[model samples]
Target: MNRIIFAAAALAASAAIAYAQDPIVGNWKTELGDTAAIAACGSGYCITLKSGKHAGEQIGNFNGKDGSYEGKITDPDAKKTYDGSLTVSGNALKMKGCVLKVVCESQTWPRL
Candidate 1:
């Protein structure tokens, strides 16, 4: 009985650790009204469109933690990629992409 209890406890602890490692893993509603799914991919997170015209398209890749992340974002319409960063607050995620480290565009996405 003690061994069984220990195993259960270990499972629960690992689950919590996994969640804490990537609090941004979930679906979000983009400013343009599309659904974006962010999930762990390889060493970081991959953002893919789950709805709208761009469904199934991977638009972003980020690596970071504690509500802040940095990586690359793609403009689906333009077929261009830019330096990007993400900031999470409560149920909202602020995404920013920059061109030449000067011109930047930002959008806030709410968790779905």
Candidate 2:
């Protein structure tokens, strides 16, 4: 009986972990053509560059849910940080960043 109870507990834990992962939690090719890994981080989501000049750098934090997020992102190419928003759907993520509500750039990233 104890072994069966433990098995059930373990299964439940594994299911919870799987459910915790958001749909956006995966590796993707960035707009700048770099590779990035996106996953849950510290009560939000984190974007990390895996390849390119900014390899292994955390680009920014995204706070949102249901395929939409707003946060800050670093543009490695330009070496700038700006307020950013991301929308993910069907293996594609649309990322937009604005500099002080003025200059804004958008890019579409596909899952890798």
Best by lDDT: 1
Worst 10 residues of 2 by lDDT: 72-81
What local lDDT score does residue 48 receive in model 2, on the 0 to 100 scale? 94
Clashes of each: 0, 0
Q: lDDT, candidate 2, residue 2?
A: 100
User: For model 1, how does the per-residue alpha-carbon lDDT over 1-112 read when each residue is reduced to its tens digit?
Assistant: 9999999999999999886766688999998899999999988999999999999999999999878999999999899999999999989999999999999999999999
Question: How far off is model 2, as Cα RMSD?
Answer: 1.9
Q: Could you report the Cα RMSD, in angstroms, for every candidate shown?
A: 2.0, 1.9
The candidate 1 region of ten consecutive residues with least summed lDDT is 16-25
Candidate 2: stretches off by over 4 Å: 1-5
Query: What is candidate 2's local distance difference test score?
Result: 0.90
Per-residue lDDT tens digits for candidate 2, residues 20-96, read 87877899997667899998999999999999989999998999998999999987767789999999898999999
What's model 1's lDDT at 95?
94
